[model samples]
Every structure is written in C-alpha cells, then in structure tokens.
Target: MDTVLKINNLYVGLKDMTIVKDFSLDIHKREIIGIVGESGCGKSTMLKSIVGLSDNNVSIQKGKIDFHGVSLRSMDQNQLRSIRGNKISFIFQKPDYTFDPVMKVKSQFFETVKFHTDGKANKKDCYKRSRELLEQLHFEAPDEVLESYPFELSGGMNQRIAVAMSMINEPELILADEPTSALDVSVQSQVVRTLMELRDKTGVAILMVSHNINVIASMADMVGVMYGGRMVEYGDAREVLQKSRHPYTKALLDAVPAMSQTMPESIEGAPPRFSEILQGCPFRERCPFSENKCETEPAIQGDASHWWLCHKQ
Candidate 1:
C-alpha cells in the first residue's frame, strides 16, 4: 500500500502531563482508520497533535509526524498553516459552531474557497464550486443549503455542509472527530455512507475517532483500540473487530450490545486521570486476564500491519 502518513514514537504532553505516549501508525492512501477508546484516552489529544492544535503546556516530547514524508513536527506555524486545511482538514460533530449566525452559508463557503485557492478567486466561481461540492455529497437543494444560516438548517444538514466544505479544500487526510454523534441512526448511516463514498471517489485517507464500535465496523478499513493514551491493538477491521487479541480490545468489542446473548461485556473502572502516567499496561488495572507480567511496561509488538501493545499479546 502507498503510505500517506507516518506517526513514529509520537509523544504529546502538556507540561508534565503526557497525553499520548510512544504512539506510531502508518496510514495508507484511501484508508479509513477508526480509533476507539474511552473518553480522555488521548484520542482527541492525538488528533490535535496531528492538526497542530495541541494547546497550552503541550509539546511533542519525543517523536515525529511525517505527512507525505515531510516532518510536520518541525514545521513552523506559518508552514503548518499552509498545510493545515489545504492538505489536511477536520470535521467536527457539529457545524453550527463553525458557522456564524451573522454570516450566510455562502460567506463561509467562499471563505473556504478563498483559503484553498489563490487570491484571484471570484465570488460567482466559488458559489458554483460550492454547489458542485454540495451536489456531489447528494444534497438535493444545494442552492438553499448554501444560502441558509447555521440556525436555519437542521443539524444533519449543517454537518453535511461542514463535510462538503472540508472536502472542498481537497485535504489529503481528514481527521473526523465524532462527526455523527449527535444525529439519529438513519442520518448517522447516511453521513457515514457519504463519507465512505467520498473516500471511494477521492482516495483521501481518514482517521475517524468515535467511541461507537458499530460506526467503526461499518466504515473503517483498519481499527485501533486506544486505552489510557496507548494503542492497545490495531489491525485490519476484520481481524481487530472479529478476533481482537488484546484483552481491552476484546472487552470493548464485547461491550457493544448485540442481538445475540454472547456479546462481550464492557470493562469496569474509569480511565486514569491525565496527570497520572501509566505504570504498566494501561488496561492492566481493568483487565480480567492480567498477570504479574502486566505490572511491568509492555511493548507494542506484532506484524507491521497488525499489532497490539500488551503483555498478554
């Protein structure tokens, strides 16, 4: 597979607080990587690091992020800004916050176009392009959607528009942070379908962060189970979701409510506070199969494409 992104031994910290420790992953072109973990497991923190938004007291303690093989960690703020949205974009769960009530949707669309295009862009041309993007995403009334304010449209519509606008920049990778958490099931499925279709057509790599396993199972090419700032397991969707190796991964997989009586049970115990760095396997405290070996630091081991960071593995 053609690699688009590589995160090597990436450690992100806020002063003395380490949110992501020794994280690494190679993302292939056109791949949708689903990242699952309990809240505050560094999923959001890792995404922020990728987008150059890890705020206050945070710095890359030790590691590098190579986007298309260029070291993003060393890039100055200006250089990072040049790459941020034009080559990389983020889609949040809600779009209302992104749109200003004082500004029309057309204004936001043109702003997006202006950011991605040279200053010679015309308003009429941007409108045409915006409509094309909306239509591409299967929005029926593209014109109305482009004209409506954030308060006027439904939550789903605004989210779809946000997605369309993100793609308008032609980002090489989109880090979606729970883009469907607020929608109904049908709309959630629709949004996921739209994303998958866009990837199929555009070949943009996506890292979708969501706690919802069902959503990941539906859209991800690879699945990563994160717990306590560590990637417990990452593998092909088929393998990780169906035959999870790490106990934490298995417990997460089992937690999903299934029609069958044999679904895996959710692990008990709260995720450790960010101030407390993990001593051993992060999940050892909650693992049912934990042993003495788990008390010591565990290595992330296995094949290049399929691996887990666990003592038991």
Candidate 2:
C-alpha cells in the first residue's frame, strides 16, 4: 500500500496554548484510520490543520504534513486551495451547514465539480458524474435527490449526499470530522457503510475523527486513542480495543455501553486544560494505575505495530 499522507511530531496551538502535541501517523492507500477521543481533545483541530482550514487563532507550531511525498506545511494559500478539494476533500460534521438550503442539490454539486475542474466540465457533464456517484451510494432515485433542495432531504440523506459530493473529484484522501455524529443510530450505520463502500469502490483512504469508540471499532482498520491532544495508544483496531495497554485506552473502552452489562462505567475526572503545561502522561490525574513513574513523562512502549505511552505494560 502506498503512503497517501504522513504526519510526524506535529504540534498545533491556539494562541499561546498548545492543543495538539507530538502527533504522528501514516495513512495508506484505501485505508481507514479512526481517531477516538473526548470532546475538546483536539481531534477536530488536528483535522482542520491537515487541510489548512485552521481557525484564525490556531496555527501549526511544529512538525510536517506530507502528502504523497510533498510537504503541505510549506504550501501557500493558492497551492493549498488547488489540492484541498481536488486531491484532498473534507467532510464536515454538520450536513445542514455544508450545503445551501435554497440551492438545488444538482446546482451545488455542479458548482463544486466546475470549481475543481477549472470550469471545464459543463452542467451536463457534472450531472452525469454526480448521478453515477449518488447511484453508487444506494439512492434509488438519484434524479429526485439532485432536483431537491437540501432542506427537502432528511439529515441522513443530506449527509450521504455530502459524501457523494466529496467523492465527485475522486480525491485521494478524505478527512472526515465527526461525519456521523449528528445522526441517529440507524442512520449512522447507513452512513458508515456508505463510506466503507466508497473506499472499496474508489480506493480512497480516509482519516476519520470521532468520539464514538463503537463506530470506530466497527469500521476502522487501525485506531489511535487520543487524550490531551496527544495519542496515548495506537495500534491495529482489534489489538488496541481488545488488548489495550494504556490506562486511558482501557478507561475509554470500559466506558462504552454493552448489551450484557447493566450500566456503563465512566472515567473519573475531566480532561486536563490545554493552557496548563503537561508534565508527564496527560492522563495521569484520572488514571487509576498511575504510579511514581507516571509523574515523569512515560516513554513510548510496545512494538512497531502496536504501541502506547505508559510506564506499565
């Protein structure tokens, strides 16, 4: 598998406070990497930085973002814009805000195709392409969806359309920031399956950020557990979820509700404030297994494929 995107030692900050620290990962062709963490843990911020969409106050302080051997960190606005919606596409959490409620879906889809193609593709050409992608996403009547306004469709339908639009350019990578967070359980499954099918058919790699552990477990080939804007544990999805070594990872899994279990277990204490400089493990304060070694920053432990930040095995 070819490496589509790579990040090494990334540090992102909002004003003076660091939001993401020393984050690193490699995404390969047709692969799905899921990032799971609590709200405000920098999951959304990290995704925005990848596409050069960071807010006005936020900035990348260190590290490299390389796409297919090219450095994205050094690119200017024009350079980044050419690649953003073409080679890399972003699927925001809220479908309601992604499209114009007053505009017909077909017109909006055509506009994106035109912009990415430099106006080479006419409305007819855009319609053909959009219809094909929508059909693949399992819309029985693709024409109806194209003619309807965004306000006319259900949230799930709109989100699926958002997925289709993201694929209109045949981007090599898709950065999804909580794509299914706004939907109900059943709708969430549909959207998840649609994304998985899209990968299978188009060979597009995806970097999905979500707070739902179960959703990540259901679809991700690899998983990264984050806390305090840093990855506490990362490995093969099955390995990290079943044989997790980091206390934070264990706590996250335990917090998931199970059918046989009477009640879900919750992790004690809130996440640390980003303003306060972290000394040791970011999870030390809430960790039941914390020891003297945890007072000092723990070294990376475990093998290449599966690793964690901790003093204990």
Candidate 3:
C-alpha cells in the first residue's frame, strides 16, 4: 500500500508544557490507524497538529508531517487551509459543534461543496452526491435531512451528517478525533459501520483517535497505544491487540468488558500529566511488570511492522 501520511519525531507543546513527544507513525492508502489512549494523552492534539488546527499557544517544537510527499509543517496558513478540507478532512468528536444551528443543512453543505470545488460544482450535482452519500450511510431521508436545521435534528442524525460532510471532498485522508464519542452504543456502531463502508468504497485512509478499545479493535488495520502523550506500543492491529508487548496496551485491552469474564480489570493509578517531567518509563508508576530498568526509559523493541517501547519487551 502507498504511504498516504507520514509523521516523524513530532513534538507539540502548549506554551511551556510539551504534550506529544517523539511520536512517529505512518498511514497507508485505504488503511485505518487507530490511536487508543486515555484523555489528555495528546490523542486529540495529535490530530489537531496534523491539520494545523492547534491553538495559538500550541507550537510544533519539532516534527515533520508529510501528506503524500507534501511537508505539512512548512506550509503557511493559506497552504494549510487549501489542503485541510480538500486533501485532508477532520471529523470532530462533538457533532453538535460541527454545524451552524441557525443555518439549514442544505446551505451549510452547499457552502462546503463550493469551497472544495472552488465553486465549479452546481447545486444539482452537489445535492445528488449528498443524497447518495447519506443513503449509503443508511439515512432514510436525505432530502428531509438537507432541508432541516442542525438544531432540529437528533445528535445521531447530526453526527452522520458530520461524517457525510467530511466525505464531501472525497479527501485522501480523514483525521477522526473520537468521531463516535458523543453517540450512544447503537449509534456508535452505525457510525463505525458507515466509516468501514466508506473506506471500502472510496479507499480513503483514516487516522482515528478513540478511548474506546473495542472501536479500535473493530476498525483499525494498524494500532498505536498512547500513554502520557507518548506512543507506548504500535503494530499491526491483530498483533498489537492480541499479542501486545507493552504493559499499557495489555491493560487497556484487559479493561474492556467481556461476556465470558466476570468483570473487567481496570488499570490502577492515573496516567501522568504531560506537564510533569518523568525520568523513566511513563507507565512505570502503574505498570505491573515494572522492574529496576523501568526506572530509566527503555529502548523500543520489535520489528518494523510491530514494536513496543518497554524494557520487558
């Protein structure tokens, strides 16, 4: 598969505190790479940094993000904007924040279509495509949805619309920051299915950040486990999820409730805050397998396709 996105040694910080440190990953064409981690571990920040959406206080101290051969880090505001919604799109966690409550869905969607196409596409063609995408995602009434205001629709409806909107340009890559976080279980399942179908049909690569382990297990071809703003484990999804080498990755998988198990075992102790400076392994405080070597940062272990940053591994 072709490499669609490449992130190398990225370091992102807000003012005095660094959140993402020495993180690197690659996403291939038509592939889904799921990043699963606890809140404030820089999962969302990673996505924002990729699209140049980080706040004024946030800074990319060091890194190179290449989208197909283009250097994202060197791009100016205009350059970033042109590529953001056209070549790369984002699906935010909050569906409610994505739309203008006062505007009808039709007007908002039309504006998006025009923005991506540089006003070359007519409303007739845009509407036709919109309805088709909505129908493909299992929407019963695309016409009704297009006519309704965002405030009038349910959360699930708006989320599906948000997903549909991100697909408007048929972007080469989609950065999803907990896209199903705001929905209920059933709705989350539907949205995941929709995303899977979209990938199958359009061959768009995805970099998704989610706290839900099961969601990652269901959709990701590659998986990266993050802790304290660092990638602790990364590999092919099957190996990372089933034959996990990192203690943090195993803990996350163990936390997921199973029908066969009496109860899920939650990891003890909270993830260290990014603001705190740690000398050794970030997971050392909570790692059950921690040893003397864990007091010092361990070297990464494993092959090119599967690796873990841990002493035990």
Candidate 4:
C-alpha cells in the first residue's frame, strides 16, 4: 500500500509549552487511522498542524509532515493553499460553522469546487458531481438537500453534507477532527457508515481524531492511543483494542460502557498538563503497576507491528 501522509517526531506547541510531543504516524492509501484520547491530548492540534491551520498562538516547533513524499511543513502559504482543500481536505467537528448560514447548499459546494479549480469548473458539472456524492452518502433526495439552506437541515444532514463536500474534490486524504462527536447515537452511526462506504468507493485515506473508542474500534484499520500529547500505544486496530499493552490504552478501553451489568472501570487522576514539562511515563502517576523505573522516561517496547512506551512491558 502507498503511504498517503507521514509525520516524524512532530512537536507542536503554544509559545513555550509543547502540546504535541514526538508524534508520528503513516497513513496508507484507503487506510483509516483512528486516534483516540481524552480532551487536551493534542489530537486536534496535530490535525491542524498537518493542514497548516494551527492557530496564531500554536505552531509546529519541529518535525516533518510529508504528504506523498513531499514536505508539507516546508510549503509556504500559497503552496499550502493549493493543497488545502484540493489534494487534502478537512472535515471540521461542527458542520454548521463550516458552511455559510445564508448560502444555499449547492452554492456552497460550487464555491468549494470553483475555489479549488480557480473558477474554471462549470456550475452544471459541479452540481452533477455534488449530487452523485450526496447520493453515495445515502441522501435519498439529493436535489432537495442542494436547494436547502444549512439551518433548514438537521445536524445529521449537515454532517453528511460535510462528508459529501470533503469527497467532492476526490482528495487523497481527509483530516477529520471528531466528525461524529457532535451528532447523536443514531446519526453518529449513519455518518460512520457513510464515511466507511465512501472510503470503500473512493480509496481516500483518513486520519480521524475522536474521544470515542467504540467508534474507532468499528471503523479504523489502525488505532493510536495518545496521552499527554504523545502516542502511548499504536498497532493493528484489533491488537491495540483487544490485546492492548499500555496502561493508558487499557484504561481507555475499560472505560467504555458494555452491555454487561458491571460498571466500566475508570482510570485515576487527570491527564497531564502541558504547561509543565513531564518526565518519565505520562501515565506513571495513574498507572496501578508503576515501578521506580517509571519515574524516568520509559523505553519503547513491543514488536514493529504492535508497540508502546512503558516500563511494565
């Protein structure tokens, strides 16, 4: 499989505080890499840095962000703009905020296609493409959706539209930041199924960041568990989810609600604060099996296919 996006030893920060530390991952063509972590774990920050959309206060301090063997971090604004919504697209958490309240759905789609094509694409052709994508996304009445305003549709409809728009350009990779987190249970399932089907049909790679482990378990080809702005464990989705080694990863999976009567186990202590530089394992404070060696930085353990940073293993 061809690698779509690569991040090596990435470090992102807000002024003096490093929020994303030594983060790295390779997303292959048509692969889904799901990153699961609690809030403030730098999942969104990492996604923003990949697209060069990090806030004014946040910046990539060091590391490489390569797309198709090309350096994305080295690209200037003009260069990045050409790839932003064309070769690479972003699906934000809030679909309502992504579109203009006043603009009709079809018009918004046209603007996206036109902006990426430098206003060379015909409106009629763009409409045809949009309708096709909406249909694939399971929109029964694609034409009605195109004619309606964003506010007129439900959150689920808007999110599906967001997914459709992201695929309209046929991007190589889609950086989805909590795409289904904002929707209810039923809608979440719909959006997840649509995205999975979209991947099957288009072969577009995806880097999805979410707090929901169950969602990740159902769709991701690879799973990455992050804490304190660092990847604590990563491996095949089944291996990481079922036979996870890292304490943090285990805690996360245990916390997920199941059908059994027993309550889910919760991890003690909160996630580490980035303002202060953390030494040793970030989860050492909360890990039940912590040893004296855990006071210092833990060495990388496990095989190439499945690995983690911990002293226990």
**C-alpha lDDT of all candidate models, in order:** 0.84, 0.92, 0.89, 0.92
* lDDT tens digits by residue: candidate 3, 56-143: 7898889999998889999998889888768898888987767888888877778887876778879988888888888898899889
Q: Looking at candidate 1, what is the lDDT of residue 90?
A: 84
| TM-score list, all predictions | 0.95, 0.98, 0.96, 0.98
Angstrom error at residue 159, model 2: 0.5
For candidate 2, which ten residues in a row score worst on lDDT? 257-266
Q: Give the per-residue Cα lDDT of candidate 1 at 208.
A: 88
Model 4 spans > 4 angstroms off: 259-261
Writing each residue's lDDT as its tens digit, candidate 4 over 75-109 gives 99889988978899999999976799999999999
lDDT score, candidate 4: 0.92
Q: Is candidate 3 or candidate 4 better by lDDT?
A: 4
Write down the RMSD of candidate 4 (Cα, Å).
1.2
Model 3 regions lying over 4 Å from their true place: 259-262
User: Model 2: residues >4 Å from true position, as ranges?
Assistant: 259-262
Q: What are the RMSDs of all candidates, in order?
A: 1.7, 1.2, 1.4, 1.2
| CA shift of 178, model 4, Å | 0.5
Question: lDDT tens digits, residues 151-197, model 1?
Answer: 89888888888888888778889889888888888889888988998
